[model samples]
Target: MLKTLYKGFILSYLLITISCTTNQNSSDLIQAIDNRQTDKALRIIDQLDNLNEQDSLGLSPMHWAAKRALPQITKALIKKGCNLNITDVHGYTPLNYAIKADNAEIINLMLKNQAVVYKNGLSNLSDGPFVDWTEKGLYAYYLKHDSISSKSFLLGKFINQNTRYFKGWNGDTTTYTITDNKIPAWEFKTQEPIFVLGDIHGQYDRMVKNLQAHGVIDKHLKWSWGKGHLVFVGDIFDRGNKVTEALWLIYKLEQEADKTGGKVHMSFGNHELMVLNKDNRYIANDYKNLCNNLGLEYNTLFHSNSVLGEWLRSKNSMTKINDILFVHGGISQKQIDSGMSTQEINELVRQYLISGSSPKNQDKLNQILKSFGPFWYRGYFMDRSQYKKITEQELISILEALKVSRVVVGHTENDELSALYNGKVIDVNIPLAEDSIPNQALLIKYGKFFRLTEDGNKTLLN
Candidate 1:
């Protein structure tokens, strides 16, 4: 009995030791991937006993590699015969993540490895692609050409409001319209009524209703505010599942408003810049699966080569209307010191997006992309260890430099549209597109500012 007990204890100890070592190596591999140490992750994977070991997020090394679009690391993992079809905690396979990244090389690698697209019986396509588009419901077929371009032929079937429809590419550039990709003037001195809203995190339905109620759009969701200006202070990406729909709505409104002698301005926000830069941390799961079905990445949909992508590039980073400066984030004193005009700032941002910043302009680009930059600075609300408070004198100097009386900003979330610094700075970033309930926005008309709600009620503010 004593000898048997000794053997049992020895076996248990060995198993526990092996388990601990495997867990440690697995953790190290994940950390390497997160830190973007591709070579180190590859090395760890080679030494790892179980390549499918998951981290707390239930994503294995393969999933992370594919999600981050690290083609070399993905190839290394494939060579090691890692399980390609392993699903993460989100019920997404490695191939799904690769598709989300829109990484063609990695996606092709996974497909060649026989990564499963369906789990049990339903195709991942059944989950849908756009806001109100689903394969199962519409019997939608994947087009040979992914984008709606003049050169590519589009063929697909869809159902809207229970009406079955088929759309065939006519090879006409007019059929699939690409907006005139020209940057518009950012400075305006208009007396027409202005409606300004904050970050719209992909809540398309809520945004349409909010605009409709405020008399910006008519019943058909077309721009009806003739000669009036509608400004969206950045952030029409990520979070909600209807980002694509919201973007299309804005795109349509922009064109219609232009025809009616009105203007629709979408300033670049932090999320917009982040998405354009290929940062997909905050993207919704719906988008991941949708992109998987589309055989593209999220950024690819808005890349310089695509239609909406070009339109987005044409947008400004900041706009000034009648002494009121509208920016996604408030300006800092450092930005004031930079002395970049509104047009220069827009031009620089556009250049950076197109080809990245030149080495000579690296220092200036750093300041622009920093937390204290135009689309990110929140010093007007409060200061932190990283962001110091902008004093009243500093604010005056910034406004005077920009030749604006007040600055209106979004990004700092507030319960309602409020004023700070004795009404010098106004925040319109209420809970708008993040939820289903109606939210308020800032309205500037008749030389007075007011808070406009979805019910068309306007309350004067300073």
Candidate 2:
């Protein structure tokens, strides 16, 4: 009886010793892997008395290595005969852990070793989450499998049309073919030339009333008067609540005129140039929020530095209709003396329009801005009192130098309606105040002799 009892004691001691040894090895191996000590983890795994021992976290050293993305350690454990399909508390096998880590290297190694791709040794189609897993996960898996082909497709898609990637700032070379299917031919010249006025700062509701009194807008929003040809001097952006509505109506009219046998000519205004030039310092208080809402990065839009600025630089300063030279601002003697041809002027305008942010030609841009042009020269023409004071001799000399009979401008804020100067120049700064009167636009009708009309009120000025 004593011999049998001693033998049982020895057997129990041996079993406990073996269990403690396995547990200690598993704990040390998992710790090394988790800490990213790849070299130490490999050494610990190799010395393991039992290769299949599970850690306190229920992960084999192999699973820990794969989860931590330690590919070298994972390979060493696999060679030691660690079970690749052994799952943890979360039921994530070594392969699943690798996928979650996004480690393509370890995943390929496991696949090459015939590790299971389908979960629980079952086909993925049998499970619901497996569909999502396979789509996102399997796509990445295949991409890793055939990297060359997948990358090629990605490159091709980047170059596809309708993508914004290629449509970057080049120059005038970037041509936009007139895609508006409603374009009318030049054969549709109206008997009366249209006069489009540009940016009216504030001066709202009053501008509408003036146009209505002039018979431009009837009881309906229809453009009834001034024949079919419509001219809009630009700006139309700052200092008005109905700016968007006004621009929308005008834009609609432009489209309508294009479809019909009519014409619409728009000139660049100083305010438009100001907005384009990022003269935010001069922008009205009401327009600041609207500008932000429209994502108008003025610096990027108008500074001659960018592509758009280059295009703006190329726009014509003014258009000639018979005897009158209608300009946004007014021209100086220097421009006329420069002997620039109409085509050259048009090209310069194109450059101005295209140069996006800051002017590429800084000196030239400054020269143009400082000269008596659309963007500059406000003191001479925009100031009505100044215009009224200038002698006829000075006016005739300037007009003669430019080879024009008369000048029509819209820069000054004329409170007494429109001003007729020396029977040659017309200032149409339709006043905004309630006390102001004769809010009007000068209409020039082309007959054998030119007939000048204020609003619809026709009069002979010659």
Candidate 3:
């Protein structure tokens, strides 16, 4: 017992000594940074030969540079190959420190240097802060900078499409409005032709190419499908850099589709929900740099006030067209049992999304957010790697409960578009944005399924 106690004491003493030595080495660098002696700091950092080493406070020199908004030092640390995504003791990244300093330039530099943007690591904005900024501060900044008149700036940067502002009241009653959104209902009982595309994942060029090849859109991205309805089965964000370009194209097409009697519907995917809620782990670094440089939070790009953002929020994750149901991730029996009606489920989901808590049925909402929601349920296709896979009988049960013939979904990454459960469940997220696969979509015409390729040809699905 005495020997064991001595050993423990020696180990503790050694750890303390090592920690003290590290702190001593880091102290000079921190002092130089606090004293604003950049040259001395840089010299001390070099002498220490620990560009990425954390101090007693778990803050590296890179963190200090970022907190100070010193772009030059940040760049130097990045060139020295520091761990740009390293989180400090407070769960703050270098990007977060820069954003806290309100140094957009340094934030941009860190983003360019491949700093992390997951959660609130970039903007120090999420939840209450996110809601507050999007509501009051952003437009105030626009007014302060005299940029309310630039329509392109407003739409592209602020995610809004507005030309004028009017505070007039109608007979002393205040009113709010959604402008010029004229899409049809979420669920359509129409027997009309439907073209269903999977996740685009920021692949603008590939999306354009596929749409052109299928004659769905003209070279200018105008709708050419006439009365044929087109649906995107969730996940239009993250993993690639051309998200803004793709979103603008979709926005333009929605208008053209409406004018031509066609329609466009974008369902919500898990990734979409994650980003809207300020979780950006799957986002690309280029997107991070772009948003930071433009002084745009990822939050602002998809708030309730934004055009596409509002439209997305108003959309249902699951929609049934004719007899075929479309969703992002596949559904399960638990989700089917959660609510009595489709409208009920949709309302519950949208409500939970806005408020972050379920008002009435907390149990149902929690299940939906977990393994069996319309946006997250993946049991139909994810059978091998996952602990749980919804059985074939369960899939049929869910479909029967929902009164749908088949469930088409796009969340699981597949090498090829797959039709599982004997044609009851179809997985179509080929990730054209990431894999550069030949553009493919599922076409349902008069209740028959076919794979529509880029050659404008349709192969019958057996």
Candidate 4:
């Protein structure tokens, strides 16, 4: 006992010595804030020469403090004249972090100090004057004398057969046309190049830039990849504050692609199911605040009446292009063994989406919406102890049953796009929205697979 105690004392003394001798830096300050060492972080903040200096992932002290909801550290950074509007590598400002945390005091503090909200098509204005697209049209909501109030100054209406215009009370006019939403084909045998994008998670600008760079969309952001197919394998919602913009872009692209010989497939993921089922745990605060300001539920924004909502309901949960099967999550051995066809899976999931209710405690609903479902399964990537990991032979039997060469999925994140299961499964979820890595997509050109980067460069994958 004495020997063990003496060893513990030496280890503690070494730790203290290391801590005392460590050099102070902005990165250290950010770490301190993340560790919740409030007093130490503050002292480091005061001693640091540059508060805006970012670490590897483009996070500074301001970003960390705001995200962690440390108001005192936030105030200290503001007092130090830190750039309030400084965006991280992922194009998120400190105010965006504050808004995500849902800290009203920090949000108000940033707004009062002239921090720019709504940068790059993302809404950061919460608990104050803000504008968002409602079911009717673009409306403005503001806090008035401790009570919330709103007025529809810009009322959008269908003015003509080919045009819809937004007319303000002051007669300010803007016009656009809505596209006819059509459900895409489930299976394709195209010889043309196929591009597969993983979960976007509402990073509109990043998605657009990646598409534009790859010549999928032109400078005007219209479909340019004629005769080629683009598949978004589920998850175009939640996180990153640009869900609205991302959804609209996909909507627009779907119609444009139909105009030519091209096709765009939108497969609904678990996040889509969550929102429709009133699961807002992973939802961004900006959206929550928008719903609060409008006095409506979050799911109501995407109800049948709304254009995006109606369009989303028509999406598939899985699609097949040639011998490749694209799904949001992996298919379990049991799911495949049940002899459920891809069409049946899509149909059942679509029905659940349309119902827009809790799927809890129901055996039929649980099969499609629960962990073993196509939208939630991750057995290919990791093993859940309750459910044994699928063996190589089980995977082979599953693929043979589906008649697919390989299955592509996006729910499980990886450091890079990876091929596993003896090249039978591919994981495209690289966590693009959270990391400062190269934007990549899986490109299949004439039966050859390649990792296509944002610069239109393709690296062949075996």
- Give lDDT per model, in order: 0.76, 0.51, 0.68, 0.74
Task: Work out the TM-score per prediction.
Answer: 0.67, 0.49, 0.63, 0.65
Among all candidates shown, the one with the greatest lDDT: 1
Task: List CA RMSD, all candidates.
Answer: 14.8, 18.4, 16.7, 20.3
Q: List the residue pairs that clash in candidate 4.
A: none
Clash tally, candidates in order: 1, 43, 0, 0
Put the candidates in TM-score order, highest first: 1, 4, 3, 2
Worst 10 residues of 2 by lDDT: 124-133
Q: Which TM-score value belongs to model 1?
A: 0.67
lDDT of 4 at 112: 52
Question: In candidate 4, what are the lDDT values of residues 30-59, reduced to their tens digit?
Answer: 789999899998888777656888888888
lDDT of 1 by residue, 1-462 (tens): 999999999999999998887788888887888788988888887877678888877899999898788988888888888898787777777877876787887875675465644433222222111221233453222212222221111133444435433332323111122344687899898999999988888877788888988889999877899999999999998887677668877887888999999999999999999999998878877666545453656675566755567678888999989999999998898887887777888889988888888888888889888987998898987887777788888898888888898999998998888877777899988776445545888889988899888777778887
Two-way lDDT contest, 1 vs 2, winner: 1
**Per-residue accuracy of model 2 over 1-462 as CA lDDT, tens digit each:** 999999999999998997786677677778878899877777777778566667666787777777899989878877877788776777656776776777767865674464543222211111000000121121111011112221100000112223212321212122111112221222223466554453455455655564566556665555565345655555554555444335435544554455655555555667666666566555444344322322233233234532233333434556666566666666655555556543445445555555532555554455455535444555444344323334567677778866677776666655533435555666555544334355455566653222233446654444
Candidate 3 displacement at residue 407 in angstroms: 0.8
Tens digits of per-residue lDDT for model 3, 118-167: 44223221111111124422221110111232111111112232532222
The whole-model C-alpha lDDT of candidate 4 against the native structure comes to 0.74
